[model samples]
Target chain A: MQRLVVLPTSRTGWALTIAFVAVVVAGIWPVIDLVNRAVLFLGLPLLVVWSYVLIFACFAVMLIANRVIEWQEGEDD
Target chain B: MTSPWPLLITLTYVAIAMVIGLRARGGRRMNSLEEWGVAGRSMGPVTLYLLIAAGSVSAYTFMGAPGWAYAKGVAVFYVAVYLAYLALVAWYFGPKVWQFGEQFGHVTQASAIADRYQSPALGALAALVMSIGSIAYAVLQTVGSAYILFVMSGGMIPVWLGVPLVLGCIAIYLFVSGQRAIGRTNAFQGVLMLIVAWAVGMWALHNATGGLRFGPLFERLLAEHGEFLTLPGAGGDMTFSFWTTSIIVSMFSFMPPVWTQWMSASSARTIRRSATWLPTYYVVILPMVVVGFIGIFSLPDLARADTVVLEYAMQHLPVVLVGLLGAGTLAASMSSSEPFIHSVALSWSRDVLQPLLGLSDALTGRLARWMIVPLMALVIAPLAIAEPGSLVMILLVGLGFATQVLPAFIGMFFWPRASRLGVMAGIVAGFLVTVAFTTLWPHPLGVHAGFWGLMLNLPVFVAVSLVTAPADSEVVERFFRIAAPRGLTRLGSGGKTVAADTAAHGG
Candidate 1:
């Protein structure tokens, strides 16, 4: 997990990019409309709930990427 | 007549911010342009986070988010995803910038590009684009502060007066302390805005619904005003593609202020850690969204959707709380606006003027910076005062143009083959195309203008670069050395398989 810092590296970057594209696709259009058609979860629309989920996923990924940077900085010493 | 309580609270916040600004300077001699412009590159994570978040969030969250929510419904959530992506963009790009700045003494974004591509013209071009965006954004903040003042003062202070008054205060602190004042003040404002945003969001929920939970209330909105809960909301304006593009455009806008903040950090890890904690601040403004939703039912006939947050604050919270929260909201806008104003000043002085005049002296740099602080504020104040109907559109166009610069950074760090000629051509072409898409033809195929511009820009940039000369090998190596992956491979160039890496960094 920590090794993934400096995510601009082609391999890790590709994976993150794919994940983000997937997230973007899932959040927009046809799919979001599909979620909108569903029943509310905890009183919020499924689409809104889904956006939070995707955003959280972004946070989780960023956290790992951050750790990677920190871990590598330590290695530089 | 204006209420004394709200005025008092706002004044207290301002007074505290002023003291913080003064203290931030702390006897440090700002001997060079770098020190004044980037806080001498020594900000910790906490100060950096506050500065970045306060600079970015601004009137957009406390006021505009609720305004969008009140007017358009689910369409407003575009703020959420784009902001998250912006953090991601910052996280990915910021550290590399810090490394370059540390190694190269680069203060302005244009300086980095000029150094990297060995083209002073390219750097000047970047400074030009960023100045336009920063000035427009500062105007938006001015308008936002005017509205907040109008609400807090019970309409005693008008927009024309409000614009100069707020900008005047910002100009003073900024001229005196530069980035240190801005960073320290942001720490106070950031925490205050967060606490207040949540409080107001929850209060709006309770005041409107007779309860704290918004899930049930929102479901009714879905049941009754279903259009509000879906795309092309309320007015049928927000298309799926538009929503996605707005977020994408925002993520890639690459404002100069963010560049200054990123370069100002003490370490790359500070940037990463600050960026990591950034998303949690999302919850801070969730209530503003809820306030907008409340406006959908409670204040149905209000003329301006942007006034929703203020209306809710006045109607729901007590006078004292309104005073306190209003101070926070106004503080948020003011904090964010200062950076925009400051960036414009920095770019105009350090990037544009110095290059044009060929000044290398530290005293000259500081003088140029000081001159622009008041000059830029005065230039933009009237426009904010005029309160043109096209302010939002102008801001959008500015941001669209800002997006044109993204390819340069991408080319510099990731694509070794990206030539200066190609970038300059792409920027010109992209700006022209964005203008066409935004004004002449709004949202081609329901996609936002900025995205349409990029759709054209990226291909042109790549095609031209492939044919033209590449940047100096040594310059490319220096950028890549810092941004390079573990084995000194340039960004997005590690481990073969060019196609995959190319797609990953394309954003």
Candidate 2:
């Protein structure tokens, strides 16, 4: 029987969790203020681009996390 | 007669939506609460995706978002930020929620929480509090639909007439079909809204800059309105603190309708996959926000910024496109409202009335189905007609109230030491603080009232739990065993094994 783990077991899962939190925080205040400028990056404002970038960053982290979850499920099965 | 085309097209769309919703039962019997409340928990990923995405987008995307963007500028992007975070939250929590629901016959969020803490009264309390938020949102969407029809029909369909006409149709379908109706109609409405958003966006871009390109228009906006591109926004009222804190509050708020959507999914994998792809659908918001930015140039100085999109469409777009935009707005409003309305009925009957009155499951389901009419007609529709002040403010305040339950959720999902008394106290304290901050102080120290509420709630919860006796160990263990069947491992410490000990086993 698989033992109940209170947190993610995989190193990648831990790293991804931290990274995802960082990415979300980066899209908001204080950290976001650094990039919240009037300048354009690839046709959009820097702040707007940063928000989109963070969104994709979150997607990437979650996708990897999904893989980890599936791997764990495989072990359980 | 003001060309009658826009009104005709919008009415036709409403009729089509009603047909879709009524037919969604697929000739199956919806005799039980499970079938009506959550589609028997059989929703596939595609429909779940649209239901969640469409429900979250709401009339706010069409009305409130552009209103904020037009009036405040870059500050409006906060909507996009929180929306992405909501997807991430669902991905993390969805599987656990689904597991518990499958194992323990949980059809509502309150039911799950109630089961975990072993308190039906707590469940009833949560149901009452969450209903407040759900009602506020439902009314907002109702008002939005009425506004769209009013504008589209050149005031021929007044707010009083329009509110009943459209909502009445949605009410009838919901009364008959339930979440199956919500699933089908959301998918249809989701597609229609996306098309309308893109069409309206591209047309606006072309008209504003003389080409179908955002680059030139954005450059022009930068050159002319530089302040709009940065923090504090055009209005400077949406401060950095306010913006960031609002996102934090929104990301955690346990909105009842969203929980129902999660429970409706076919599997944990379906929920995860749906959450994974839901972010991409938020691209719909971009075009709508752009339409607002376009408004700054095309039709500046509009009273009530929510009307920017509709006003712009009427003034600039072709008649057919205007009608299409009207249909799309109605879709956005109805798609969101249906689920919240459904959730209110389900939560009330199952979580509150059932436990209090000791009603049977079949009877509860029947009551929930019938409850939709009186609630919508008597409560929700009348509020919408009253036209409550500031859609975004109403939404934010509702979220503030809803997020008070986060402490209870933390206990259920993570901390076995957390007791029922602790959670109840925390929610009460949090609610009081939220009310005070929102009304009297108003974002004290520039932080959101919801966050401020959490500030008081967390400590009270931790302190109370530490000082008091913990919950029944058997109940806690049962929840953990199902929710984390493979055992949840610890995060950080390089995936090191810190013994879960009694905590894992629910001591």
- The digit string of per-residue lDDT tens for model 1 on B1-507 reads 346898788778878888898788888776467777899898999899888888778888877788887888778887887777778888878998988888898888888988888988889888887777688788888888877787777788878778777877777778777889899999999988988888877877777778889876887897788888777788788887788778778888888889999999998889988888777677666777888888888889988888787876777677777887778888888888888888877877777778888887585557655765566456778888887788777777888999988779877566666779888888888899888888889878888888888888888888888788776666665665566544223344344322323323331
Model 1 segments beyond 4 Å from truth? A1-25, A29-31, A69-77, B487-507
Candidate 2 stretches with Cα past 4 Å from truth are A1-5, B390-395, B486-507
lDDT of each residue in B202-257, candidate 2, tens digit only: 89888888887678877988999998898888988888899889899999997888
| Chain B TM-score, one value per candidate, order as shown | 0.94, 0.96
Say what the RMSD of model 1 is. 4.3
Residue B158 local lDDT, model 1: 79
Indicate the residue-level lDDT of A40 in model 2.
88
- For each candidate, give its TM-score against the true structure: 0.92, 0.96
Q: Which ten residues in a row have the lowest lDDT in candidate 2 chain B?
A: B498-507
Superposition error at B450 for model 1 (Å): 1.1
Model 2 has a DockQ score of 0.45
Docking class of 1: acceptable
User: Under CAPRI classification, how is model 2 graded?
Assistant: acceptable
